[model samples]
Target: MSITPDKAQRIAALAKLAISPDQAIRLAAQMDDILGYMDTLNSLDTSGVEPMYTPVEHVSVLRPDVMRQDISRADLLRNAPETNGESFVVPRII
Candidate 1:
């Protein structure tokens, strides 16, 4: 794809980047070159190739979830300044 200086200026504006006119012209050429390479890559056939998220072989190791004893309610409410018989008692937010 060809990238004009005007297109580069608009792209810079959209990206919130500051660039000079000369820099925009230079960058537009570079951007055009990169896009041309991408276009070349896009023309390659990969019909039988599998899509990969990562280059490396990954194994997600996870710990087994086991049922365990939970802390008693009385123990949990011990440190609270204001707690009812069941739960915490805070000032009404509404």
Candidate 2:
């Protein structure tokens, strides 16, 4: 899997990236190495291995939802610096 500078430039353009000619050349070589490694991995034998949905074991630690009494509006508004007996007052915006 040889990646040319032209191919690297095109890939960068598709990804909305700007790279110099020297950078493109460097990126092409790096991409080629990565693809070569992928090819090497593809040659492995895994006939007896079980298919995995995820790489790590996942456990849901969600706590049980418990209903509780709601606080009164007066109690909530008590800490407000400025209020109109219902809601907090702030400088008006345009």
Per-candidate Cα lDDT values, in order, are: 0.91, 0.91
Q: Which stretches of candidate 1 lie over 4 Å from their true place?
A: 60-94
Question: In terms of TM-score, how similar is model 1 to the real structure?
Answer: 0.49
Residue ranges of candidate 2 with Cα displaced over 4 Å: 46-53, 59-94
Best by TM-score: 1
Error of 1 at 44 (Å): 1.0
Q: Give the per-residue lDDT of model 1 (tens digit) for 1-94.
A: 5899999999999999989999999999999999988887678898999998787676777688987769888998999999986899999999
Model 1: weakest 10-residue lDDT segment is 53-62
Which tens-of-lDDT digit does each residue in 7-41 have in candidate 2? 99999999999999999999999999999888986
Scanning candidate 2 in windows of ten residues, the lowest lDDT window is: 55-64
